[model samples]
Target: MGTSAERTGLPDTEGISALPADVPAWRVLLSYVRPHRGALLAGGVLSLATAASGLVLPLVVRELIDNLGSDGPVAELVAAMAALVLINAAIGALGSYVLHRTAESVVLEARHHLIGRLLRLRLSAVERHEPGDLMSRVTADTTLLRVVTTDSLVGGVTSVLALAATVVMMGLMDLTLLGVTLLALAVAVVVIGLVVPRIHRAARHAQESVGVMGAALERMFGAFRTVKASGAEDREGDRLRGAASEAWRASVRAGKWEAVAGNTGGLAVQAAFIAVLSVGGARVASSAIEVGTLVAFLLYVYYLMPPVNQLASAVTQYQVGAAAVARIQEAEALPIEQLGPLPRATDQPIPSPPPRLQPTGTTSAPAAVTFDRVSFRYDPELPVVHDEISFAIPPGGMTAFVGPSGAGKTTVFSLIERFYEPDTGHVLLDGIDVQAWSLTDLRAAIGYVEQDAPVLSGTLRENLVFGAPGATAEEVERALRTTRLSAMINALPDGLDTTVGHRGMKLSGGERQRVAIARALLRRPRLLLLDEATSQLDAVNEAALRDTIAEAARTTTVLVVAHRLSTVTLAHRIILMDAGQVRAIGTHRELVTNSPLYAELAATQFLATAG
Candidate 1:
């Protein structure tokens, strides 16, 4: 799969382009600021006040020097100086508070919004995108946003305000000196113009590198056990190191550009000060400018250095922030799955299907699921996984799909769950098109357990109640018993409170499968789909699972993709599949007597075990 940078064709610094062009990146960034507008306003005002106070100090110093003897009280001059220091300190504190608060809020909101979008996104979109890249957005990219929000914005604002105030103070002292300062500042602006975009591009690349590194790490860790077992740990380590090195190189490039911007600004400001002092000194000596005014003007001119430096810093920060914005926008731009409104019960409810055929009578009659000439292909250019596949499971019964690997058995469950829409034909539920029903409603009506039996990192009780949050403790215990996991639960030191490690790696395979079954059972789904849940289990474990499935089928219509011959034998009817097509349909005994492929498979399994 192509990396996000390669796919989007964005420069490394530009990050992902998750947002539409119609939506301005600045607008999205500013949205985070909206909630704390009042705080920001106060911070800005404080910064301005500090700048104004800084301007007043030069004037005070000029007066104090000019009226040294008998023109003013020394105590008054001392008091004014002390007041300026106190005011500046208070303003600085206020500004810091505002900036810090804003940064926290931005990070918090961005994380929450991104996570929510990720959860709501379609499974297909997630499958296509790398999890490492997504993780980068949440972790590394968001951290950059924090810097942009607090330090960048605050520094940029203070710099501009201080520069403007300094310029005005210099003008009051001597307009000629002010003109010289402004001219020097203009040169610095040109230098900034040349450098800002480079910084932007560099910063973007640095962020992209982080994402790439993250993706690489995720791939390595996702299959850590397999990689270790295959003796490929050294190779995986080298790959991750390469990704980290790339990120480091990109960051260095960005830092180099930032250094150029800072140094260039500093040099320009110093040159401006030299020109102003030389020219002003000559004017004072010639009596063209007052000595007091010359001294005050020089002070103001010196003050311009900070603003000039700040302007450069702000420009660099803006570029970095823009890059961060692009990354965040890309995350927001993923295609999210749209869930419809919740279904409401009507006074005139739809009539129930026949009692003998009814799958479950929990809330209402179970919806009948039918795949009418369904065709599906994961890749558009590749051969279909399911080709013109047609099947119907009545309201209630056990229907098993039996086939070898690559027969597209699991694809059937994916289709029924609407995880992937069919390329052709329609999937109907209770006579209505599957798409017509809300995603939530469709999924709520069906329970699916995968072959690997994925379990989340949480307590045993948390995992049990995950599918149906409202499931009572008694209900949880009952479901555990139904899945034959009660013994495992009893054996655990923490029982229901035991924490399952990442992907439930802490538990045995059989324990994880049972936990998954218990979770699905808690949902009380009308249609239960098991995708070879017993494929990886031992005979004893498989028998226990079979009993659990049998119990579940009595209340819910169970459709299983069978891997073992024993599992197929328990099915009321078997749909024999081959190369994405249903080749035969009959009981195991009937298929053995009639279907040539079925008989061949049974004979092969029996012979292979005997040998």
Candidate 2:
């Protein structure tokens, strides 16, 4: 398979991920914070004010100690210290709330942007990555932005500045004690610098393992019935266990490195305190500094703990968050469809039972389709599915494509829908190249039903109107009747409101096919492409739907890929195909008489006399 970039016409690098390898992690983090700078600034200021108050408390203690013998009363100084502590608490609380609120807003905006991009991704891009892996980027990876934006960025700046101010205060008290403090901290700084980079590598691996585990779970659930029927419960369970264990082991590695970096700060502070205590005692005895000054100096060492710990924590968080940011960037780099302008979301109350959407198609005339020498392959390494094949269908009536499997039958519908572009040549609608047409306008003109006839998990009524949300109640009723589904729906307790289980498992194969056809019919499309649409229906239903399809072909262009003789006989023209090219095109009698492949197929199915 081709990489997402190769398949989607995006810029490709040597590796699988499209993450801008040269962009710094900090720059990506700042982009999320730029919109909320005002709030972040206010919070940073309040935090600095809180730190200032704490720094002042140690000075007041020194004055109170120095004046103890001469003061008539020490009550005033004690009360002043108490008031400063209270003010510090209040400011710290307010600042914390502001930063947290801003962090949440950043996360909300990130999710909105990611979701919009993911939904608009080209089909080729979606196919290249697992659904579960993409989902992890939106949910797990985006959550990390909260801490990176606030605690890592804003908190980091505040911690560094407070550390600087505390160091200046200590220097004025005693240079000897400040020297001892810096020596003890230097060892920790070296150790942390060596350890921080490891955290980033470990964290990225852990997150990737988590995505893998999610993909494993999605695969099992997607084919839940097959697993159960095959009696592979223990086998599948073991696969899930293996993935979970890998994620756990990777997480433990990241946590171990984080723990080392975090505790190194506290250890360094304790060592500084012990050294300051021993050195200050000697100075006091030698009359180099007074007891009061030694006491204040000790208080400053204790105060250093908070800022030092904060800096360590900020670094550790950044290492982890940067990994997540890289994953998010990789997801955002995928190619997205160029859907035209869309309406913005708003907070205004929408009326219950919302207004219907207007159909984009202007006329009821069937659309003309032409494939001009189209040659395509899904990947460069794969063989061509269409080898300069050319075919055209006029404005109306039914056409059927018949061939052995792998003759590029389904590729025709894929080309028309522009799901994947051809390597060479043009696919035109109404004589206009599809590439030149607006995606919305081109797709809006047609309705497509795939080979599987899949239905989403929803109520029966919801599935019926999915293609045409604005379809009226009468239109829905008419579609149900035309598909011969009205009686079955009426027999159910909820009628149209009855729920269809996941993938419509509650309905039979034929019923699901009918529901799909009804959905396409409600769109009132100019072109209807059905790939083996009636393959699953019973003989009675099949005959009824053949008549329905014939009726639809009068005003709509209907294309079917058929294998059964019953359905093939209904087509106005049959195109016989083999390998990657069109071999013959004619009515049933003309094909049987002129094309040996068609005659052999008809004889094998005992349809020679019928034709």
Q: Candidate 1: misplaced stretches above 4 Å?
A: 1-22, 69-71, 151-158, 341-364, 605-611
Clashes of each: 6, 0
In candidate 1, what are the lDDT values of residues 1-611, reduced to their tens digit? 64333465432222222447347656766676666667767777777787778888878878877777447666787789899989988887887787787677667666766776788777778888889999998888887777776646766777777887677667766788778877887887888789888999999999999999999988987777789899999999999999999999999999999999988888888888898889998998889887778888878877777778777877787788888778878877777866752233222333333232124325334457788898999988888799998877777667899777799999888877878778788777766666666677778888889888999988999988888898777778888777778888898899999999878878888789888878888888878899877766667767877887786777678899876777777888889899999899889899999999889887886334323
- Candidate 2 yields a Cα-based lDDT of 0.85
What lDDT score belongs to each candidate, Candidate 1 first?
A: 0.78, 0.85
Tens digits of per-residue lDDT for model 2 on 1-611? 74344476543322122236457788877776777789999999999999999999999998899789667457888999999999999999999999999888777667766776788798889989988889888888889888877668988999999999999999999999999999988998998999999999999998898888888888898888999999998999999999999999999999999899989999999999999999999999999999988999899999899889889889988998999988888888888876542123122332122112346433377888898999999889999899998888998899999888899999999989888788888887777666666677777878898999999999999999998888889889988989999999999999999999988989999999999999998887888999988888988888888998899899789999988888888899988878889999999999999999988987774364233
Candidate 2 at residue 507, lDDT?
A: 95
When summed lDDT is taken over every stretch of 10 residues in candidate 2, the lowest stretch is: 345-354
Question: What shift in Å separates residue 166 of candidate 2 from its native position after superposition?
Answer: 1.5
Model 2 stretches with alpha carbons more than 4 Å out: 1-22, 340-363, 605-611
Q: In lDDT terms, how accurate is model 1?
A: 0.78
Q: What are the TM-scores, per candidate, against the unseen true structure?
A: 0.90, 0.90
